[model samples]
Target: MRCLWDCWPMRLTIKSGIAALLLSTGLFGAASAAPAQVADMPPAGEGPRGTSQAVLGAERYDAIGYAVPYDGGANPGAISAAHPTLPIGSFAEVTAIDSGKTILVVIAEQGLATPDRIIALSPGALQLLGRPEAAALGVRVRRVNPLGADQQALRDGRPASARIDAPAVLLAALRKRLPAPPRSVSTAMPRPPRASNAAVNLGAGAGYPVPGRAAAPSVRPATSRQGTGFFVQVAALSNGQRASDLANSLAGSVMAGGGLYRVRLGPFPDQASADRARADAVQRGFGDARIIHE
Candidate 1:
């Protein structure tokens, strides 16, 4: 037979046999059993020992930067706002960045400001901030007081409570000095039966007399308190007689103060109820009837 090294096939077969023998003897097993290469690893740093625990961007937050008007009209001139996160009855301090004018505002309603805005202020706050056109910008806000659990609980489904309560508290302090509600005001007016066309007898070339609707009783205007709770100021007047006449016509209630009589209907259970009363008062010819807070 040809020599193993001289014959190509025999030479290759002898080499493979020797390699298998070495592997079975465990001579090169250490190399074969070594850990995988970087290419075969999980990732650059994916193992249990490789991960980092530090959080990224933990301090990122949106700061209050501007103010919009709280347009609910319940407490027009009150220092109040609709906040995105603050619970009702919570109080916040607002500072105008440019003017450095700071004021306290109560959380009255839940709302998110525009991405570029922060809180919505009441007319009074807006005016105090010197932003009377319904909106202000470039302001800073900080929480001054958090709502207590009990009051926040009471204001859970009732957002108006905060707006109403602030003014109510102030009103309570001044109640003893305030004038009492007017009594015995008659809002009654004569209501004639509608004249039927048939009763008038339609005749050719004959003009029939048409009676106009009765005029609404006149009343004085009064300024409303800036608080929450539902009421409609149908009329306000310094003239007691006119105020009494209007109150009597509407058959509602009256409050007199500061030489002015206010024909009002309240304290309704909710804003919707008060709004409906406002509409009815307006329809009844109190042209300036509007929703107001007690």
Candidate 2:
């Protein structure tokens, strides 16, 4: 009968074969897990942990690095690329650092096998750059908006113009974050119609006057005080016309002194008489009226 335990040489051969089988299986599983060396970019708007963390090459607007070329889809002449962090539908101009050959490619998807390579371009894109799809080629990628002039340029088979300078881009970004300007207070706004009520009932003489209403035909003339007794001084004003109008209405006098037109009802017998006169002046809308003596 044959022994189940075979000779040492045969046993070693079987052991090696089993080991090789396990190794190949492990390799296949790892390959299947992250196949194509990259995963399709997570759909946009995924939570931070999901997809929308940010761009990988975002540190530099103009990224300079090597690109791995791969076939994107059926169209061999498709202008597309996969950037680890660029927005999926955005456009970029990829240029060969050495040859300076550039081609505008839309970022169709995302994911990069590693951070060492800045981007993964379609074989068609590399072809446009005049580089071999299999070899390493350093590139310069400038981000662009497809809605901008780049879209039309691509359609015309022309290159996109370089964007505004760094200072201009910085200024634009700052402007967007700045607070809105304060609205101007309008000087041309319409004024309220003048008060039609008698100012004697109100306080001050506000705007607008009906012509005949202010004529006081029975008003008394002011008695001149020869630097004696107290007087009820209605107002001290700069405008002669305004002072004169107030004096005429209150049966007072306008005396000009020290750059002011003084309106006063004067020559009262005593302090009590002056006090009564002051109260009358207040009732007639001279709220600032007070007793004064010469």
Candidate 3:
């Protein structure tokens, strides 16, 4: 998911120091807000803006290198990418020639220098790319102006045809399956539900009455902290042979998750350690070993 910052300029002045500290610690600002009702949000594959056309090329560098860290969640909808030099938030299109599939992913974070690759695919994106197995798959990258009608559709919550070909059909199905949008809580005149006197006593007590006796203590919800480490994402595959070939090449360094075989280097405690692992992976022929948060 994208990090949605409050546009209030005054808040920046009030908390510049705090913001800097949070950034240094890898905790993103604005993520502290209660989680949004993302259920209504479209799936990651719901549009073409998320899809791009990339031209495949030979691995550019012999060794992989790490890029700077990104603070956003591992959400495919956000237009972020890991590039050798492109500023954060820059937009690009990636196309897989083998399968004729394309996706537009933004530079959300920095990426490895080796495999001398274009963009790293998000987990959702990797699935869309057909899951190639080679240590590195060919990809092409080009800058795109992110202000077209397609982009607008994404920003405005309209379904993009590139991602959701049958929006109406899908929406209809979802409406049938999901409950209506929840009503907001009213602050005034709150009233308790109608219940018997015994039931009301149970509600007022520390533990509610169960059929047998007291109810168990309520457990707090789990805290949702972001992953601390990073992994490389290989998106797009032409065919099973390509996927198998890539998988075999990086068999030692790769692990499968969410259906994609991710090539990772470290649970490094710091960026320096991660960088070293990335460099070593590139030297060992895993040219596109990018550091991604786990």
The candidate maximizing lDDT is 2
| Candidate 3 segments whose C-alpha is farther than 4 A from its true place | 1-73, 76-80, 132-135, 152-294
Which of candidates 1 and 2 is the stronger one according to lDDT?
Answer: 2
Query: Looking at model 3, how many pairs of residues clash?
Result: 33
**C-alpha local distance difference test of each model:** 0.47, 0.51, 0.38
Residue 283, model 3, lDDT: 76
Clashes of 2: 1
Those runs of model 2 whose alpha carbons end farther than 4 Å from true positions after fitting are: 1-60, 146-149, 152-294
Model 3 lDDT, full chain set: 0.38
Please, what are the lDDT tens digits per residue for candidate 2 over residues 1-294? Answer: 554668887799899988889788786356568745442322222211111122344542455566655444224356666665665556776655454455677765443433336666655666666664334455556664444566665433344444322233333333333332212212232212222211121224332221111223222233343356787777654345666687777777765432234577876989999999999888878666767676
Where is the poorest 10-residue window by lDDT in model 1?
195-204
Instruction: Return the lDDT, model 2, position 241.
Output: 64
TM per candidate comes to 0.31, 0.31, 0.29
- Candidates sorted on TM-score, descending: 2, 1, 3
Residue 128's C-alpha lDDT in candidate 1?
A: 64
Clashes of each: 10, 1, 33
Candidate 2: clashing pairs of residues: 55-85
* Candidate 1 runs further than 4 Å off: 1-62, 146-294
In candidate 3, how many Å is residue 25 off?
A: 64
